[model samples]
Target chain A: MKVAQILKTCTRRAVLAAGLALGSAVSATAEEVFVYNWADYFPPELFDKFTEETGIRVRLDVYQSNEELAAKLQAGGTGYDVIVPGDYMVQQLAQQGLLQEIDFKTLENFPNVEGPLKFPVFDPERLYSAPYLHGSTGISYDSEKVGELEESWSVFFDPDPALSGQIVALDDELEMYKAAAMYLDIDYCTEDPAEATRILELLEAQKPHLLMYSSGGSIERMAAREVPMHHHWANGPFRVREEAPSWRMLFPKEGVNLWADNFAIPVGAQNVEGAKAFINFMLEPENIAAATNFNGYANSIPASRDFIDESVVNDRGIYPGEDIETRYVGNRLCSVEARDLRNRVWTRVRS
Target chain B: MSNRSAHSYLAIGLPLLALAFLFFGPLLAILAASFTERAPNGGIDWSGPVFDAYTALFYTPDLFGELEPNRAFLSAFSRSLYLATCTTLICLVAAIPMAIYISRRSERTKTLLLLLITIPFWANLLARNYAWILILRANGLLDSALQSIWPGFEGTGLLYSETAILIGLVYSFLPFMVLPIFASAERFDWDLVSASRDLGASVSRTYGKVVLPLLTPGILAGSILVFIPSMGNFITPQLLGGGQDFMLGNLIALQFGASRNWAHGAAIAVGLMIGISLVLLCLRRLGPKGPHLSGGA
Candidate 1:
């Protein structure tokens, strides 16, 4: 009830209590690591294995969106030992002073993490976060219904009235606004009022022909052929393709929005030792491979290729290519005022 | 005497205090936040009360030009009112006759009918909505059934349309409309109907004059129950309507969550409360006789 409001004012007390809680929790024979991550993010077996080996119970909580996670952490009293934030969000949290510095000396397996994740821009020296999964957001469509569909954001932006009620764009403001900006050849994170108007018009044009704006549920409808084409997130499109093989994911010529989710410890984490142990265990090649195979996202562990699911390993949609570096778009974490302006326009898109 | 007074105080005062702290307390906070200034980091500024957020609802701030009223918020408000009225009307019409029929049933049959009406409530709301999606979508239940009959027939896509949103709304609110109306109908004076018929009133006239008027209080209450919630319900439109739908509830949620504007979200919520209150005030005129014998035998 009133707990949400109380939590906001309880920040200092929670921080002090959690700071004291850390040492006591570690000195205990068995401790509970308060792990918080995305809903359906990791394999259940991973937690069970960690608990069995280390005698530390994994008390996990799931968040559906980064915004929701940010809200809880911002309010404080979350009492989480570990939190997995998306790439941009990790830096966002770090900048907000909400995350603790990662102690790499405690994690021996940190060197095994390679590729773009090694010296990730979000944490250049790997001090704040480590990559959990990397994937690209793009177009996922039914091949049989729309034969020879081009790899373009135009399918979502320049909708055909003939294809009315069969197209969907993601409901995410930050992500889909990027697609709209890319489609119109404009900066996604602009503060210009005229640019906001243009983006609004672009989205409004798609509304008549648009089926729905969704975050995660668009995949279910697309897989069921309820929607012929959807502006989809990377991992969802890959998972949906497995169910409906005729479904294909396309990264446009304008390029794609690649997401890298990372594992980070929040400030005032109560079970730091247990959290570090869990993270180190997760960083192992076999354990990381288990995550990739089960969750259908590419992990950063270099030798994970050997243990990853064969279908996922060979699939073009899952592993686009080695040259994903050229496709990377810098995630510009927009300032609050800029985001407010964009969101004002976004409300117009919904209407 | 003082001890007994203290006992009564504990009995009433404690619960009321708890309720105020738990429910009304938070509601007051939200109402307060609606008038407050937004901090740069998206928290309430708490410096002083400001009408800027309320004005922001209807007008955009402009430095170089005069501010214009926000058309998007107005349009979304109108759309929510329109959809809520539509869902209420459809539910009202379908519920009345069904309630009457159920009320006229034998005791065993009446229980069965009421139970059947409420079976949907047992399932999670989201899962029940998903079941409708599976039933109504292209190549889904209805589509496959049609295909079996016609052989290779492609079905029309319905899941993400306004039509689907209405269907889902009507399905959801049907029982809410029925139970109250059924209770009002079940205890009706059958002798009055006989007297009307015996007095040589025409069959249509007897029902129109006598039966319909008696159900008005229940129908009115049911409509209020259905309409108020439907105005704010974004999930039905989101899931069944394919996220193509934007209701007032989703708009408020967007402000708080993705938009990260607490002051604006609170303003929108206050707007919704005012709208619902206006509608509720209007419904009081329709239900002047008040709900009848709901708690009685």
Candidate 2:
């Protein structure tokens, strides 16, 4: 068939699906929910499952980055019922009055969420958001390329000359500088000028070792052997391993950057009731497990442990032990000075 | 004469008014934005005027602090200039021959050639870039051809490189250069060259002194057409040069994209416009002076 014909058919199917979803949403009288979340964060089947169990139909939109989603919300272009933001962005959005206060009464499974997931610095007292997925930033490498992995951050930062032009680092400012701070055992979000200067020097030193800095699809490149090692989010590397198991992940002994994304209703949502129902439905153990399995990220709810595979739940990479936890630092929203320093440093690194 | 004059005014004035409202008006808004401050958290302040954005750009440290000290702004500007020059040169070289060939052809042949040149315009820019990717990637057709020609040849994956960027820019802007040059070449006077030859001048000298001067107008128009867009292009550099090979257009886009600093982006854009204007002014001053060949024809 011609490409035009294929496109026309695909568009027709999409329009039909949209019409059916709208019809169900209108008939149910349970408000229409519009969710904005990360690309491929939720299982496609879960939306259908929610519609089947509850009469509320959910329309989902996906964003590639937290900054992108935040920009859209700030512009007031997207009318999202629920938005998933990373831990740092949660505070930023709440401060901007973009998020709505969550009603605990509506969330039946709220208590089942782990204790560690609650009382995050970004959303203390759980007033605005609920934890969705948790993961860490760490080194993922081909075992064949870098034999017998040592947990030191030095392997990436000051690698042997042989490994030059074969390493990729995270493009994000917070993650890159935080990794530098971890190597020095200093505060990740330090306001001290001297500490900031030291971090910049360290990054400059590591520049020769890096092939490139990239945020999106760097892990995929790593799997393709374009680069042997990369600083990647936990889930991406794991997903790569499913395709090419020779690639392995290691949490640096110095520390790993932990992050959690949460689902919160935006302040101006038109479908608050439906949003609440969707959130409640997603928090259920089985559905959360489906999301975790599909995306290969650690589920936020402790109840999901029962539904997920024991192997995935027990894996040290996904659920790091207490020692790993001790080293892990959840990225905090930096002060204005620190944020500026980070942006400057990142600009330099990229330039 | 009065009716003809009024008709000409109406024909030109309406389009000029529309252009000023639609194009120049938004461009002025962009210029205004550059003078404003960026808010602490990414957005533009619009509250006060500040030069901090431009100043901050200069102070940003070099990549790896290697050769280029002021790397952020300077490197991007230099890269953009370099790419634009390369693209313009490539277009000039390729367009002259093709335009000459077409101009010398019969009217039917010329029309067919023009139609053929425009066939690629049916495809989207993104699709054309993607098609280049398919041809240029590792293990792609280019690589395969090279490997077959020379045994044990390890192909350089040239898809995301400066060379690839030049190829894309040249391909996209070739027609702009060709159309104008063809217009001038088509009006070439065979009598002048014959007269020069008959006066005992060499073939090369007669062609150079007679044929070259007549093509100057087309060359100027085509250069301006290709150079303007090539300097400000973001997609060609972004897709073909990789993220590491930063360009002025990419930096401007970043100010709008991840940085959320629209004012800075606007400032960069305004700077680019000024740069283009200066180049055009220099060309006009330095260009050759000759009588209009078309008037005699």
Interface RMS for model 1: 4.3
Model 1 vs. true fold: TM? 0.88
Backbone clash count for every predicted candidate, in the order shown: 2, 0
Can you give the DockQ of every candidate in the order shown?
0.39, 0.30
Candidate 1 fraction of reference contacts recovered: 0.64
TM-score for chain B of each model, two decimals: 0.90, 0.87
For model 1, residues B1-297, the per-residue Cα lDDT tens digits are 799999999999999999999999999999999988766655567788888778878896532235887766787688788888999899888888899899998999999999999999999787688788789877789888988899978786677787888888888988889988887798888888999999999989988999878877777778878888888887787777766667777778777877778888899889889878887776666455344423311
Query: What's model 2's TM-score?
Result: 0.85
RMSD to truth, every model: 5.7, 5.3
In the range A97-163, model 1's lDDT, one tens digit per residue, is 9999975534788888878777777778788877788777888777877767666777667855567
lDDT of 1: 0.77
Instruction: Give Cα distance to truth, residue B255, candidate 2, Å.
Output: 2.0
